[model samples]
Structure formats: C-alpha cells, structure tokens
Target chain A: MFGFVNANPKSLSEEEKAIYQAFYCGLCRELKKRGGQKCEILLNYDSVFLALLLSGLYEPPENSFSFKCAVHPLKNREAYENEFISYAADIDIILSYESLKDRVHDGGALAYKKLLSSLEEIYRSSAGKYEDKAKAAALCVKKTTEAEEEKVSDIDILSSFTGEMLSECFVRKKDEFSEKLFSCGFYLGKYIYLLDAYYDYLSDRKKHRFNPLHLMGFSNMSDMTDFTEPLLTAYISECVNAFEMLPVLTYSGIIRNILYSGVWSRFNIAKKRYLSKEQKK
Target chain B: MDPYKVLGVSRSDSDDDIKRAYRNLSRRYHPDANLNNPNKDAIEEKFKQINIAYDQIMNERKGGAGQSAGRGPGSSYGYRQAGFSDDSAFGGFSDAFRRNNERQQQSDGISPEMQAAVNYIRNGRSSEAMHALLEVPEYERNGTWFYLASVASQGMGNMANAQNFISRAIQLEPNNPTFREFSERLNNIGAGGWYETGRAAYGNPYGNNSSSSWCADLICMNLMCFCCRC
Candidate 1:
C-alpha cells in the first residue's frame, strides 16, 4: 500500500480523470483535516486507490464540492467527501506514523522522531478507531523485523507476511465482496513486497541489507529478474482475476486500468532505471 | 435457452458474427481458462451452457435437431458438433479448448513421471517437480514437459533455465498461445527489455510491445501536456 498503486491517465476519460482527482484531493484534504497539515505529506496514490475501490464496491452516494486550495488556488478543484476517504486518510496517517516510528527506532533519526511525535495524537485516535487493523499492521512490522533478524531466505514466506497485513487492511469492512477484496489485496500486497525486494536487490546487497532475493541466492539483477518477474506477474494476474470478479459498479473502468496496466507501469519504471544503471556501469 | 442471448448476439447476426461471439465467450469462460478463478465452477457451468447454446443454434441452422437429445447438463459433448470438423480456418479452436480441460486430468496421457511432476508443481513443490521432470526420458520431453519444467525452474528462481525450457516448449508447439506468452515474457525479461522495441522508438518509455498498457504512456503524456498547455 505504499504509493505504488496508480491509475493510467490515458485509459481514463475526462470525467473519470476528474473523479480520480477529486478522490486524490479529497484524501489529501481529509488527511490535513484529521492529522493536521503536516500529515498531508503522507497522502499517496495507494490510499486513494483504496478509497476508490471501497467507494466503487460500496456504491456510496457521491458527495463532492469544488474548492480552491494552495496547489491550485486559481482553480476550484473538485473535492470528494465521503466515509471511505476519511477512512483511507486515517489509515494512511497510522501507517506513516508506524513507519516513521520504526525508522526512528532503527536509525535513531531525530527528524522522524519529531514527526512521529507530531502525529502521535492522530495515530492514537486512528488506532483506537481501527483497533484490529492497527494490530494487524503492528503484527506485520513485528513479523518483518523477525524475518530480517533471522535472515529468512524464502521469498514466498517473506512476501506473505506483507500480503497478510494488507489483506487485513482491505477487508476491514465485512460485506459480500469481502472475500474477493481480501484476495485482491492479498495478491497485490505480495506483488508489492516482491517488487520492492527485487528493486532494492543491488543496493541492499551492496549495503549488506536484508533482501530476500539475495538471501534466496539470486546473484545479479538479471538472474533476479528472470526468477522473480514471472512470479510477480503471476501475482498481478491473480489480483486482476480477483478484481474482475468483484461487482464494482462505478469507476470499474478506471480501477481496471490501474489493476491491468497502471501497476505494470511501475514495473516498467523499475526495469528502465535498472537497465540504465547497468549500462552506466 | 436462447442461444443468441447466451452468446450475446442478435438473432439477425450473420453466421460469422455468431461464430465469433461463441468463440470469444467460450474461451473466456472455459474451465481451463479460469483455473485460478474462485468462480470457476460457475464459469464452467456457463461454459457448458454456452456450448449447449452454440450447438443448439448450429443444429437449428443446419436443420438438424441439435444434440439436445439425451445429453444431460453434466454430460460431455464431442468437439465435432461445433461444425469445426476438417476446418483448418478455425485452427481447431474448439478442439483445443476441449482438450485443455481433458489434458489437465490425463497429464497429456504421458507416463507416471510426467504426471507426478505436474502434481508436484500443482502442490507447490517445485524442486521435487523439477526432479521428477529430470527423470523423464529425453526423447519423451514434449511441449507440456518443457512448459512444466519452465514453471518449476521459475519457482526455484532459476529464470535462465526457465527461459531455456520455455523456449523449447514454444519450439515444440509454436501455435500454443499460453506457451508463446510465457516464452515471450521470459525472452523480454532475459533481454532486459520492456515490452517491444518498436514502442521505445515512438518515445513511449513503457513501449507498446505487450497487449496490456500499449500506448498507455504516450496517451497519458499527450493528455497531460495538452491540459498543461491550456
């Protein structure tokens, strides 16, 4: 759920684009309102995607209004206001706070400590509201730390930890589509976990950081790509397959574009960057 | 059942249109196609309904009583009823789809070693599966064998070996879409290239080489640039 989820703007129509923007701005505004202006920095496409998915699944009444903001002071951009947006915003704050807290503890980074302190109240409130989700997230962090400490080498096991955490987050709302949503999030989470590991393999190796691919005996990027890319693609295909089965009414096209293509674009970006870096060497 | 509605076509649609619709829908709902799908049972049921619909429509058109006689819901119908017998134009699509499910059950009617390997891969024991595959006689290694070996290699993070095996699979069955797609992806990654080279020439960073996301970046860039210009 880190800012990897994005919609392919090309596949979106003007109205769909507006809807996406409204949701994005809407999440940002919610974050600022709930977690303060500083927390707005944590606004990401992943949260917006979550909001879009939940909204599409729930088919809630549309509630949007045009508003002028600092980024676009001259234009009154549409801002969507809804329960899902606020929920996503709160989840984002909690995640950011937890992530910052982990980084602060690991590296003793004073700046992160200060930021975490600032968001402490908001995090506490969000954690109270979503106790189960907060617990699941904390468990994920704990499991990840354990895996790193033990130097677990199995990519499947390591990625499943993150996948489980995300599955909990996605199925926070128990409904008819809960199972499908869980499966979709589970696979997407796995893809993200593997993609992050694959992307960081070289740097992690150089820094002697804990990378599952290196631990799994992949010596180079090409070898890593060959072994993991197919598995990653399979996860994406499974995610898309699950996504197709969900009975999404609104923004299905846009969501499909993101699932089917937008996520793949991120892979392409990583591939290009890796290729260019290799050529430079 | 209205075969036209089942195939999502109008009654006035030409034979070619009806055939095309049936082909597309059947492929989409095929049990083998939706193997990982949780709704596979429903899809399989829909596929049977589709076959029944197509058979009934074709039979009606041919002035024959259509194989609706004594064929229960769960009964298997031969692929020959699709009017595709001896027709090379369809490239035996119906036969391929029919055999896809059957092949899963029989493991392509190969020896126990091949079936064991397939079962191991299905159960997530890729190393054991690869071992089983290795024991197969070299001459007995066919497309299915190579494809399964490729999958097992991929599971073991041996992408180079996976690519080699999948290439062999593609060579044996060049017309297999699944094998071709797998080979194409393996080659693309092995070459360290994304999508196709033609797409890179068009200044599309994500290149339109693959069917998914083709021209996606170009269209997105143009749209954003146009909006910014305004």
Candidate 2:
C-alpha cells in the first residue's frame, strides 16, 4: 500500500520522491533501532508515515547517511537521525507484537502454537520497552477474542477493543490534534473490523465459520459500500482537519496526500475491480 | 447557514420535510455509499452546507420561544413558536454546542498505524490493514477508523469485514448521521428483493444453481447494483 502511494501520480517531483524514500528508510532504521533486526522485518510504509507525522514535532538531524542493508546493499537509501528512526522503530515493535498476537489467536493449533513460540522472545523484549502499551494491547485482544468466541455479535464491543489498542500508541500530547488522532484510530478500527470480515467472508462461508456479516446476514459487497464509505470520508476528513490544527509541523503534506488521494484512489480501484469481476462473471 | 436551508426545509417547512431532507442528504453523502469518489470539491461544499443548515434549523427550533427577549408584550406573547421550546433563555446554547463540536473536530489526526492502514487499504491489503489496525488502543477506535477500515476491506473485496467495522462505528456513535447511514447501507446488502427474485428465477433443483459460485456472484451483483442504485 505504501508502495502504491509512493509511486502514485500525485504530480510530485523527483525530490519529493527522494524525501519520501528518506522517510521510508528512516522508518525502517527506526524499526531496527527499537525492535532489533527481527523487528525491522515488520517495517512498512504505514509506520514510516507515523514516523513522518511525528517528525513534525522535531527537526531532523543535519546529517543523514545513505546506508546499505543486507537485503538492499546495492540500493543506498537515506536514513534520519537516531530519534526519528527510534520513534518509527518503537511503533513497528508495538505493531508487530499486536499483529502477531492477533494472528496467533486467529490461526488454529499448530499455526497458533508456532506463532506463540516465535513471538515469545520478541514479545518479551519489546514488552519491556513498551510495557504498558504492549500489555494493554494484549488484554484488549484477549477480551476481543473472548467476545468473538462467545459469539458476541455486538459491533460496539469489538470496535471499542480496537480503539483501545490505538489509544495506547500515542503519548497524549496536550495539543488539540492528540484528540483527533484518537478519533482517527477509533473510526479506523471500526472500518478495519468490517473489512476484515468482508475479506474473509467467502472463506468463512466455505469453512462454515462465523462472520459478523453472516451473523448480520449481509449479501454483497456493493451493498456495503454505502454503509462503509461515508463514515470513512468523514473520519478521514476529521483526521486531516485535526492534523491541520496542530501547531507542531512536519510531513503534513505527505500524510494528507496519503490519506485523501492515496487511500481513496486505492479504494476506488478495488471497488471498481470488484464490480468489474462481478460484471465479468 | 440557516438550519432550514441546511436541511433543505422552507422557513415555514414542516418538521417532516426537515427530517426527510436530512435523511436524503445523509444518504447521499454518507461515507459508505460515496466510497472512492475522489473527494470531489463539491461534495465537501455540500457537506458544509448541510451541516450549517441543519445546525441553524435545529438551533432555531430548539431556541425559539415567544421572542420574549425583546419586543412588546403582545408581540412577545404572539411570537411563541410551535416547535421550539418555551425556554428561550438557552437561545445562545447552540453556539456553545457548535464550539464543542469544533473542538472535537480539532482532535482527529491520522496516527502512523492509521496511515499504514490507509496505505494497506489503498494497496488492497485488507488483512494487513486489519492487522495494522489491531495496534490501535481501544479508546482510540473512533468512527473514522471503522469507516476507513471498512472501505479498505471493501476495496480488497471484503464486504463482510466492511459490514462488521461499519456496524461497530454505528454502535460507538449511534446518532452520527454518517454512521447511521453506513449501517443502513450494510443492512440493505443481499436483502434486496431483486436478488431474491433473480435467485428464484435462476433456481436449479438438482444442481441448486444458486450454489454455483458464478451464478451466485452474478445474481448477487445484479440484484445488489440495481437495488442499491434505486
């Protein structure tokens, strides 16, 4: 997804692309800084944007270095100073922990056990660094999984669970934008829940497994576009608006482009393809 | 910014008209339906107008009373409005209400995870977005996350996930016009009469035609597209 945004036709210049790559590389380095080498593997564009968004608060160091990694030794990329990179790394670790945790529960037995054993070492190390957040995210996922197991059909219950996880990531600055970030996470969590169900619908159906849509009896994807699009736009608008409100400055344009044009365009293509596939059949 | 104007109601329009207008605009701009429309400049304009108009009408209706704050006794007595409360003292309350709303708006920026989720969403990374979003703390989950995640999943061809997220959003902020519209849109899926009729038409006794993936997809698509557009 970040790759798509980086290459998107946004009328951006060569310099802008380089800056974007720097931010991306900065994020990658940060993941390594905070979570160690293994954590760097979880590095992705989203966390890079997080690094960029937070970058507004602090100035980047005067000196950046172009370094090669084991995977991309030939492709020299620019990385930011330690702190910016560190922030990105921390987020990666935290995010990776939560993601692996979710997977462990979602995947059955062998897969679950394998995930747990693999994650145990990483979780132990990262949890100490991000103690409270890691713990809170774990609890939230636990509660959420329990609810799902109990056949909890309540949408609010699950959304709140996701929202809780998002709230743990931020340091809660006194600035007004802090609250907006909270709201952004809130809505995004809700949107993700439904999308997860949608993506897994056929498989769940085939497996005769549980899905909220089946629980709710939803029939098709188009019908849901109406249900999902407006709230998304509203929240995205709010997130953008809040980011604009912040007195602190950094990478606002990059974040904004990714949110409005980048995200929306991708959604359009996906929906268009889905519709086209339906048409083809 | 007339409330009546926002709701597309006449100055003297009935409450029902105001309600109907709100519903119509809500349906039209409700995020779920307008997915991937490329953020048209007019849509934002329309949204602003509707919000302002609705706010104004709601204020007037809520605050208007005998116009007793001014004017002569007879005029004040005769000025009693039908819909508004008699307690006109709180007339300036709407300003405070709007101010609070503004403050709420000031708080909603995208987090790094949200940015990633959006990226994943754009790239059709439905599950990845879901996984990325899992990092967001509980208190942080708001209507925007749910909506965007839902849209992202939909783009990834995951309607069930979209429905689940949208439903969670609606539950969190039940009265949000956007959230409510989203929920309604999800509810309408697969429940359309046309699909049922078409399914009936394309029935197979021995083969159970509806069970075939191709037939199911076609019937669902046709019925959904036709029924929803209406």
Candidate 3:
C-alpha cells in the first residue's frame, strides 16, 4: 500500500470531494484515536481507499459526526464513520507498527527504536482484531525488507509478496466476494509495487539500491516505460476486471476513478519529471 | 456408487491404472460394442455408469477434494478460481472447453502431454496445464506449446509469464493469425473496455508521443476533487 494510491482530485466534484473527505477524515480520526499521534502520522490515502472499498462492498451502517478536528479548529467538519472505517484505521495502525518492527529488526529506521514498545502496546490491543491482516503485514514487511537488502530483483516474485500482503488486507470479512476482493488487492498490490519501483528508479540508482526495473536495462525513461507500462497496465486491468465483478455499487464511481485513472497520479508526476530531465540532458 | 468402486479401483490406485481399468471396462461392454446384444439396455446403463464414474473421479482428482461428486458435468470453474477467465475470443479455447476426456488420439501431431495440457486449460486447470506442459519433453515444444503456456499462465494470474510465453509463440510462428491476435489482446487487454466509461485519456498512462495528449487522466470529473495523499 506504500502511500501511493490516491484519488485524482481534478475528476471529482465539490460534493463528491466532500464525501471523499468525510470518509478520509473519518479514517484519520479513527487512526489518531486508536494508534495515537505517532500512528496518525502514518495515515495515507491507501488505507482510506481500503476503507472506502470495503464500505462500498459491504455498505455497513454509517455513523456520521460533526466535529472540529485538530487541523480545522476554526471550522467543524462532518465526518462519516463506519465499522469498516475503524477497521481500516486498525489496519493502518497495525501495518505501521509492523513496519516499525521491520525497521528495528533490520536495524534501519533507528530513530523509531524508542517508540517500538509504545507502538507494540497499541498493536497488542489491535492485532487481535485483525489477526489475519496483522500476520500477513508482519510477514510481508519482513520479506520485502529482506528482498530489498538481498537485492532480489525478480519483479514478479518481489511484487507478489506485496500482492499477497494486501490480498489478505482486502478480504476484511470473508464472504463470497472474498476471492474477487483478494484478486483485486493482489493485482492492485502488484501495480502499486511496480509503480513505486518505476517512480523510485532514478533515486534508487543514485543510492545504488534495488529497483526491479533496473534489471530491464532501460537507457531512458521511455525505454523503461516500454517494459513497465504493459506489465503495469496488465496488472491494473486485472484489478479492474475483479473490481467490476464485485458488488460495490456504493463507491463504484470513485473506485472506478481510482482504478481507471487516479492510481496513475504518481506515475504521471514521475514520468514527466524524469522525461523532462532526460530531454535537458 | 462410489466412483472408485464402480471403476473397480481403490483411491490408492494410481491414475494410470484406474484409467486403464476404465478403458478395458468400457471397450468390451460399451454400447457401440454391444449394438446387437440382447442386453443392450443394461449395457448402455453400465456404459453410462462408467462415464459418470470416470468424470467424478477426474473431477475429484482435478479439484483435489471429495466434494466434486455432485458437481455439474464440467469442473470449468475449478481453474477459473485462479481469477481472470481465458478470453474465449481466442478461437481454440471453446472447442477445448467442450472436449470430453479420452481424446488421446493426439490430432495434428501434438504430443499427448500437450494434448493433456490443452484439456486442463480448457477446464480452467492452469496449474495442471503448467504441470502437463512441464511434462512435455523439451524437444517437442512448438509454437502451440508456448501459446498453451501463455493461456495457462494467464489462468494462474501470472500475466508476466503469459506475455513472455505468447511473445515466444509469435516469434516462433510469426504468421500464425491466432498467435498474432492473442498477442495483440494480451498486450492491450486491461486498457480496452475501460476508455468507453472513462472520458480521460486513460489508455496510455504516459500520454501519446505528443507528451500532452493524455486526456484520460481526469475521468469521473464530477465525483470529487480532494483525493488525499500522504
């Protein structure tokens, strides 16, 4: 989920945007309350997407509240709340905590060492709720960190770990749609992982770190896209294929925006920046 | 009757031995073999039982569970459980899906293992197709082999392998229309059927060669305007 998935703002209307924000704010409040200020810092649109997706699928009871948040003390905003929203927050909190554990074990993110026990206390209370998701996140985080350190560059295998991780994350409450949900998350997870790699290619190159596209031997961004684009599209297309089959009429429009176009927000930015630089060179 | 018991083989018997038993039982007493016999009704009933037993046993083996006993005649969904149904637009898959077992004749000079792989793929058993393809000796893998591998890979949710395999098929038999058509579909699958709903230039993520022609990026323009990021 790596903080990359986002809804494209230009595509949404004022009302739709507010609706989206209501849920986003709802998730933010849940995160802050459950995982504390440090955990709130880990809030991302990816988790919000998960929440909204599950909500769209299940259409759980809505719990709307009007309140002034820490960010908007002058104006109280109406936030929509639901069990799925809280579930997403717990997921966000647990994944962040697992990430912290990974950093500590890998002896990276050293600054977070002191906060581990505190986050662990929060995680202990929350992990029980979504034991499946926590276990998957913990294992995937550990494996992903290892893949990075060991420089495992088989893109499919590397991406699949994330796929499997988020696949578990997607099936919050298993029903007949669980398989489709898992497939949706699996391919979308692969898409996000590949997109992240492509976006970080130059930066990782400068740092002499692992980026799967590096193995493709692209002399320029265009060449890299030639290899990555089809694979990426294939993945996201499979995601949409599953998404279409899901009975998610609630946020289908917004979810379609994300699946069809919004997910490319980062890619658009990364490609333009790299191409323009290459032209200058 | 228990399919294994009807077939006169225990579950412990190897697949080949069971298959041999079915062949022998069906051959001597098959309806076609007993056209003029006085006991034709009983023979036909016995033949029907033999067919059902074999199908049930195969379904059980394919699904790896005992619950396959009462499934419909075909276990097509067993393979599709991997997600992403094979595009039936490809010409051969429909016929393959309709195929009954006992197709060991290997028409068109295809290896028996490749034939088996095709049947597995037809039934949506991609992992089985993969195994069958792997069983084919390397010397016999033709363009059809690579093409079948692509189909099986796609069924298994391994599109990377599917793309790679179909490309190999094209390279080996460039003029094969089926291969060419499949390659085109495989390359452009996800982007199709999407542009109709999305007004944004979603087809090409990087936009066209013009660098600014990407008009599909803003689909669902009235939905919302504040998708938050980290």
Candidate 4:
C-alpha cells in the first residue's frame, strides 16, 4: 500500500470523481476517528480502494452525512460511513505501522524509528483488532526484506512475498469469494511491487543498490520496459479477471475505471519520463 | 455450432472481419496463454472451436483474392494449422517442459537432480521438483536448468517467477528455438504475445502498424523534447 494504488482522475466522470472523493473524505474522517489528527495523513487511495471494493461487493448500510473540514471550509462534503471503511481504516493503521517498522529496522534514520514508536499506541489498538492480518503483513515484510538482503535475482520470488501479503489482507471473509479475492490481491501486489522497482531503478543504480530489472542487464529504460510491460499487463489482466468474478454491482463503474485505467496512471507517466530521458541521451 | 456464429461474424461480413474475429479469439483462447488457469481443459476446447471456425471460414473463402495472391491465412492471421497439434507450438507446459529436458540429455548426461525434477514436474509435485532442482550445483545449471525451474514455478502458482526464469533461460541459450518459444509462451511475448492479445481485445483491429498509434507515438516523441526543455 505504498501509495501506489490510485484511480486515474482524468478517466473518471465528474460524478464518479465526486463519488470517489466522498469515499476519500469518508476514509479521512474514519482515520481521524481512530487516531485523531496525526493519523489523517496516512489516508491513501489504496485503502480507499479496498473500502470501495468491499462496499461494492457487500451493500452495507451507509451512515451518510454532510461534514465540514478544513480542506473544504466553506462547503460541507458528502461523506459516507460503513463497516468496511472502518475496516479499511484499521488495515491502514496496521500496514502503515508495519512499513514504518521496516524502515526503522533497515537502518533508517533515528527519526523513522521515533515515528514508528510514536504510532505504536494507535497501531496496537488497530492491530489488536485483527491479529491474524497484522501478523501476516509483518511476516511478509520480514520475508521480503530477507530476500532483498540476499539479492535474490529472481524477481518473481521477491515480488511473490509482497503479493502473498495482499493475498492475506484481501480475504476478510471465508466463503466462495475467498479464492478469487486471494488471487486478486496476489497479482495486484506483484504489479505494485514490480512497478515500484521499475521507477526506482535509476536511483538504485546510482547508489549501487540491488534492482531486479538492472540485474537482468537492461541498462536502458526502453529495454527495461520492453522486458517489464508484458509482465505488468499479464498481472493486471489476471487481477481484473479475479475482480470480475466477485459479485459487485453498485459503485462498480468507478471501481472498474480504477482497476482498468487508473492503476496505470503512474506507470504511463514514468514511461514517458524514462523514454524521454533516453531520447535526451 | 455454425462457424459464423462461433466467430460472431456473418457471411455478409467481409472476409477481413471474419479473419480478424478469428485472430482475436485464437489469441485469447490460446493454450499457451492460459497455462496458469486451473480450468484449462475448457480453454483448450474453446481454442479448438475457434480454430475450427476460422478454418471453416477460410476454406469457404479459399478462392478469394487473398488465396489467389498466394498469401496463406497462416501467415496473415498468425495462425498455425500445424500448431494445433504440433508439440513445439502449443504443447502446454508439461510437454514443452519435458521435450526440452530430453533434448538436453541427448548430448550429455543430465544431472540426476535435473532428471528427478522433470519427473516431479510431470507427476505434479512441483515443490519437490523445485527442491530437486536446487540440489543441482549452481555451476552445472544450463539453459535447461533455468527452463525447468520456470516450469516448476509455473506448477507451483508462481507465474511471475516462472516468467523471469524462462527469460533467463532464453538469455543463456538465445538461439535455441525451444528456449525462445518457452520464453515467449511463459511471458506472452514475441508473436501472439500479450500486447497482441491486448490490441485484439481492444478496438485496434488492424494490428500494431495502425496509422493512429504510429502518428501518436511520433507526435509524443517530438513534443517531449519541445515541451520539457530538458
């Protein structure tokens, strides 16, 4: 959930965008409700996506209301409250806390460790609610970090760990949908992990750090993408395939837009930048 | 089922339209593309139906201008009539995986672990197959080692890992058509790749040489320099 999942704003209709924003504000409000002002900053589109997906899948009663916030001081924002949003918010805290813990463990500056400890009280409260999910998330982080330290050249093995984490988090219920939900999270997580590596290749090269794509001998951006784009396409296709199996009708228009087009927003922009850089050289 | 109905085309629809529909369906339902799908028996069946429909349509139009011009449907549509049953073209994972290992053992002695891994893969014990493969010393791993690794990973539901391993296999044995074919089938690259499937699924009926995309890319490249001031 490293802030990579997003809906393409340009692709969404005005009404659809507003609907998405309502969920966004609703998630923000939920975060504030849990950990007050400091936790609001952790509000992200990925968590909002989980909330939207679960909401669309299960038509839970929404506690709708108009709320005023500093972001929109003059106008009251249309906000929604539901069990899923609260659930997503709890996951948001647990994941955020774990990622911070990873950075601090990775010999990050003292400030990061301080931040991790600062969020502990909030994290413990949320993590205590879903011990299974939190433990699974932490385990994946540990496995992924260990793989990175070992310089595992097989990126598939490296990314699979992160994918496994999402696979665990996606299954909130045990039912017919669990298998497909598990698959959806796995592929989505792979796409996110690999795309993150794709964007960081240049800096990773500069620092002489490990990058899976670079290790594959694709020194140039075009070569790297030529190697990567098909993999990403296959992954996103599988993710959408699993998503289609879920019986989700309401808010599906917006959710489909995000899954289909929005998720590619960052990849497209990064491609243009990297390709243009190649041209400049 | 009527060939036209299967292809979602009609006699009134031009031969081009029918062929295009056939091309899209074939790629979408290709056995190589859906190696990871658990319900693969159905896909292979659907692929057969698509092929039969396409051949039926093509045979009906055998004397058309395309046939008269010596351009076979095989080349233009990227369909291989032989590929339908050929081990090299659409051998799914197990056959493809086994064929390559047999070829490797022909010239020299294959490590016992490599042979064991192949048997394990054939028997649907990919986890043990992977462990057996790990027993092979790193120095002795040829393209076949990487190739089998990819197949084992495929069986274990580690698709992305499978793709990269096969790609490495191809890098090690670039000219080995079997390795190249395995890489293409695993990663969905080269001819009948994922991008082609994408173009076929989306509205681009003409293929990658469409004037619209060519012009768009040209303009984007030109404008990138002018606008960014890098």
Q: Individual DockQ of the candidates?
A: 0.05, 0.02, 0.09, 0.06
Candidate closer to the true structure by DockQ (higher is better), 2 or 3: 3
Cα error of candidate 3 at position A161, Å: 1.2
Clashes of each: 1, 67, 10, 1
RMSD to true structure for each model, in Å: 12.2, 20.5, 14.4, 13.1
CAPRI-style quality class for the chain A–B interface of candidate 4? incorrect
Better of 2 and 3 by lDDT: 3
Q: Lowest summed lDDT over 10 consecutive residues: which window, candidate 4 chain A? A: A240-249
Score residue B145 of candidate 3 by CA lDDT.
84
Candidates 1 and 4: which is better by lDDT? 4
Please write out the lDDT profile of model 4 over residues A111-224, one tens digit for every residue.
Answer: 666656768999999989998789978998899888878878777677777777777777777643465577677778878888888878787889776678877887678988
The residue pairs in collision within model 4 are A8-A262
Query: Candidate 4 on B13-90: residue-level lDDT in tens?
Result: 875577567657776887878999998999999988876676555544532311111111111122233211222223
**Residue lDDT tens for model 3, B118-218:** 77766656788889999988877878889888877776666788888998988987776666766666665543434224526433243232122111222
**Candidate 1, A101-136: lDDT as tens digits:** 777767755656666787889899999999987887
Per-residue lDDT of candidate 1, residues B1-230 (tens digit)? 77789999897776557667876787688787799999978998998898777655654543221111110011012232222221221133234434543664566567688778766654445677789999998988888788878767654434446667888888888876767755654454333333223123223225233222322333355445434533
Q: In terms of TM-score, how similar is model 2 to the real structure?
A: 0.52
Q: How does each model score on TM-score? A: 0.60, 0.52, 0.74, 0.66
Highest TM-score among the candidates is held by which one? 3
State the lDDT of candidate 2 residue by residue for A175-266, as single tens digits: 31344344444444444455455555567879777776567655566665565454344333333423432333345555655544544444
Deviating ranges (above 4 Å) for candidate 4: A107-111, A205-210, B1-129, B132-148, B155-161, B164-184, B189-230
